[model samples]
Target: MTDVESSPLGSERERIAAYPLAEAIPEDRLNAELAALERMDEKPLPLRIPGYFRLGGPGFMGAAATLGAGTLTAAMLSGAQFGYKTLWVSLVAMGSGIFMMLAMARFTAKGQTPVIQLQQREHGWFMAKVLTAFLGLVCVATVFNFGQVALGTELVESISAGLGVDWPREWNWPIYGLITSWVALSYGRGGRGVYYVECFMKLCLLAMLLCFAACLIVVGIDWGAALKGLFVPWLPRGAQGIDLFIASSAAAIGVMDWVFFNYAGLSKGWGPRHERLARADVYIGFALPFLLISFMVICVFAGTLHSAGDVPTTAIGLSKALVPLLGETGAKYAFLFGFLMVPLTTTVAMSIVCAIGLHEIFGWRPDVRSWRWKTCILLPQIALLGAWLPSPVLIIIVIAAMLSLTNNIVGWSFFLLLNDKKVMGENRSKSWGWNVGILVQVTMLNSVALMWVLNRMGLWG
Candidate 1:
């Protein structure tokens, strides 16, 4: 037969050309298979549900809770010592936190793995595995979870005393433990339970804000000065024990928040489709803390602590400063509530992230419903609680250092994943996005390391 007669015609030849080999398959079927393959390759990946909607009522609540303890400590310290002058730090932290969270959410939604898992995957399993183990050790050694619980318990005790209610120290440990355990258990059921905890936390945060606002209004502070403090940048002279402050501030803006938020984003099932929603979630989460902290610094500055020659070194001390303006009883309750809520929320959030890390490493199901997971998560904190005393400042310093050290490692991992062709396929991070993220992380890490080295050299006090 002639070649034209024996071979496929124009339409059939076109169809046949689509398949790997034209001889084996019918031309029309080959064309269909080729079309199918093209469609498969072109199809968009599954969209992650918006975390804000998926988190239901708990989305903002979780952010408020996460911001509670560290924000309080930072705000209180800033207000007591530097007055409102250091409010910029909180603003910077919150702003940076928002960006970091956005990136983290993107990674979680896209990668379907926690930061540690992504780290191991990108950096080599051995390196990533070692880093994860080291992180767990850091979490344990720093008493990151227990410290928050202890701080909360102590605040509760102080508030009780001020309100003429006595709570024994022995009772504090068990009570704090139980409360934290409850929080951890609450999350075991999935996003709703965590959201519930967050809602409760938001209420506490709102109450604290109201109290601070009232104090600010009553004290009659100069708005112009407060504005300047919030906007202007200045480092105080002869500031003692402020290196930890700077480090903590840097950490707040660095990797831990990103790491934690990404895990939360994943748990909430956010993806590229929910990018805007993720941004919104971060804005709400970040703004609440920023506002609370800024107001707190202003309240302390405009009200009682600014003129108090010797600044308060602890939450107890800062709370006492409020008595002159808010009345002893009012000040006491405000401080009590503020102190209790901060640590309670922070500890719970930290525990959840820690559990996530363990789950990824060991292939343990972090089903949030499993009793086994809950116990595994709580065990480290329990041990820490038993080993450490209630020293919030010390705890903050150590945690800050640990966070500083690891910030780059985590940040770089996210940066790499976002740019990875395999993980993100065609939807990788843009050049501008990569540059900004990398710059922020590298600057923060280097700055922290430099400060640490200087501190060790006795060049900074």
Candidate 2:
């Protein structure tokens, strides 16, 4: 296990001082090292799924972080209400997401600097701080963290009931929050091993994947119909299609997704040689598993709720919908446990991601081993006491609108950075791949956001 700090570019603290990571090492110096590696390993990276999974980290971390309860709820609802109609959005999201990740990977692979640092260097500090860093880490992720903890608390209550524990309802969320805060701590500053978060994410993703698969099998899906739904894109009349489109596109790639993966690459000590690993992380780790799990989840609900002619509006409703197939107690605990896993993984992973960004923004050490990062991870626990309290609809809407606006700005800004020769240097692929990616991200994100605004004004879907 090579130390990430053991770079030729001085010590780890020195790298932190030269924030945005790339600035720490001279371009020519890093370039020479990459050239040497390329010369030593002549052949292209082969498609080795198993080996890649073992090596990949950021993508899996992204998968775990991105596909939180929101994504699951959306997929289940989509299937429950419209059967396979919105399945095509998943395909589009995945396609758009892969290219978006690869575009960022190009930045990490070449710049060796995190995107935040690049934004600061190329544009200015305000752009980096207020727009990208603050909005992403604090405004966006932090706000969402409250809802996840609240959901985690709810799941804990359900799990307790299933276990026949007579715990007080009022204490459930606080207790669950405290327990999960500890879980997040284990993977924080004092954790063992470098790849723990990635490994943990993969484990959670695998578990969730298995849970969904088992649920699907128990319900018995219509494979022929599912396949067609997958290939054929469908849009419901009115605001539903636009709303799903926005959610799907946002799910495909968001501020946290972009920031997390780029930072994850840095944390993994990825260099030019590890570019293949980065791609593998995005395509194999994040995209493949994310889509598979989502498809399975959708299929499970579609098989049952579609025939039942009922829609599940809440997570519990979605979970209980499986009762007919898995029997009362079996289905109750199955989806309950499955949904429980979603927020736990996101909580831990997002905490680390938040720590990463906060450190960069506040000029703290980038190392997760630092207490600063650990404390940052735990700060969200404060929201647990107030977790069950109702968040204002207008407040939620305002935060979401801000997030969408910031995300669109970040997507376009980074896409421009990806093309900037000064930033990416000769490392830029400048290929059609990233070109198409930025287009997909921009179109979907902006159009959906616009529709949401219009729908709010009762103007359009």
Error of 2 at 427 (Å): 0.4
Candidate 2 C-alpha error for residue 259, in Å: 0.9
Q: Per-residue lDDT tens digits of candidate 2, residues 1-461?
A: 33334434455434433333333335555455445444534655563566677777788888888788678888878888788777888888778667778887877665677788888888778767777777777665666666677677777776787689865436777666765666666552322333655677788888787777667767787878888898887878667777766666565567788888887777555665667667777888889888998888888878778767656677656765655556654654667777777887777767766676677678676554567767787765655654557434465567667766777777778888888887776776578866877778767766666666566557875
lDDT leader: 2
Candidate 1 lDDT over 1-461, as tens digits, reads 63223322223343223211122334454345344433543544342223333332223544544454445666666666666676676666555555556666566544444566667766876445444434633353235555566566667677677768898555666777777668766762632554566566666666666766656655667667778977888776653445644644643554445555665554443333344555655665555655665566555654566766877666556665665556644544664565566666666666665666566667564665567577666764663353245544554455545545556665566677778887766556776965585657556664664575456456777
Number of backbone collisions per candidate, in order? 4, 1
Q: Which stretches of candidate 2 lie over 4 Å from their true place?
A: 1-47, 187-193, 328-332, 367-371, 453-459
Per-residue lDDT of 215 in model 2: 73
* Candidate 1 ranges beyond 4 A from true positions: 1-70, 132-142, 238-248, 328-331, 383-402, 431-434, 449-459
Clashing residue pairs in candidate 2 are 22-113
Using TM-score, give the best candidate's number: 2
Candidate 1: residue pairs that collide: 58-195, 61-198, 69-342, 188-368
TM-scores for all candidates?
Answer: 0.77, 0.87
Model 2 lowest lDDT segment of ten? 16-25
